[model samples]
Target: MPSLRNYDLFISHAWKYNEEYYALENLLSSADMFKYRNYSVPIHDPVIDPNTKVGQEKLADLIEAQIRPVQCVLVIAGMYAAHRFWIDKEVAIAQSYNKPIIGVIPKGQLRVPESVKFAAHEMVRWNTDSIISAIRSRAL
Candidate 1:
């Protein structure tokens, strides 16, 4: 059996919906089945201050660097994700890098973004088993 940590993953999410992101992270990290798995993000908390004005190209480059080494990209498929320009860019970068994209439908989410649906190589509901299966099955 391969450990979940064997696959490197980058999670693309909106800063405003970080609460859901943290919840997903906690679920993946604390689950008994994934206890030995290693799931990590390049940036611990990748929230840039709203007041901070960074160049779009520079930010994309920085995000690309984070996405480069990962084998998979996990996107939280909330409706708001479609509106976030950065998440779209992240998904594009992941595609450019040939990384597998996993769209995670957040618990209680009624709708998923089209961009997320289009980018996702696999879509999984918000459950440990489903998430782990998608990661293990789709990760490159």
Candidate 2:
């Protein structure tokens, strides 16, 4: 088989770590022949405080920087309801840069937010094969 391409990706979340986020990370890392570079801001290493207007702008800039070079943006659909603001900003950033957005519905999740549903270029399941396929076919 040919060597797999290494994709640059941005996984959107509420500026915090969650099970879905970690699961996807592990999945991608362990998948056979799949490789990726995650640009998502880790919870343990924050870029800025987002309490004030200036801070928010800085945060936005930081997020943009993370998204600018990415080929695709992976969104945790189940986390949208709770982190709509950040996720929306991430989506907007991804759109501005023409990065493909792939919404991953968490395992066993019943309902997904419309915000994510509408923004995603493609919605995928919380599985290694599905997510890898999306990145391979959809990522710019």
Candidate 3:
């Protein structure tokens, strides 16, 4: 890919909790986000195929292909995020690639999952302004 205008954020979250998912979508799509995000959901959530070995192989290939495009990873620290397999997998991949990881705590919640605290390079609230401000603070 050509040099990106801003960072590409690979989002990892637990399927059990979707509030943070929508929260992130709003944050990244905002005009104020400064083209500082190219947010993508985890590979397992997208383009999954169980029809045949060939189809599965293709999806695996696609996932492998996408790994390079991720510059940063946002991990949504939901209640069950720490125990989810796919969430863990995504975090591991981000860590291996040395991507900047930001863990967001969804609204109406303050307690953080241990995984988020440990895996994230930084952590923030899910509110749009707070999230944006955290990004700005981290940049500085």
Assess every candidate by TM-score.
0.83, 0.91, 0.71
For candidate 3, write residues 1-140 as lDDT tens digits: 45535655566654456656766776677745356655454324444553577765674454445554766677788878867765676777667767777888877877888987998878888777766655555432
Tens-digit lDDT string for candidate 1 (30-74): 766543232334343445433456656667777888888887889
Question: Which candidate number maximizes TM-score?
Answer: 2
Q: Could you tell which candidate, 1 or 3, scores higher by TM-score?
A: 1
Quote the lDDT for 28 in model 1.
77
Using TM-score, rank the candidates from best to worst: 2, 1, 3
The most accurate candidate by lDDT is 2
lDDT of 1 at 74: 93
Q: How big is the positional error of residue 48 in model 2, measured in Å on the Cα after superposition?
A: 2.3
Pairs that collide in candidate 1 are 5-38
Q: What lDDT would each prediction earn against the true structure?
A: 0.79, 0.85, 0.66
Q: What is the lDDT of residue 52 in candidate 1?
A: 50
The C-alpha stretches of model 2 lying farther than 4 A from their native spots are: 44-47
Evaluated against the true structure, the overall lDDT of model 2 is 0.85
Model 1, stretches more than 4 Å misplaced? 1-5, 33-54
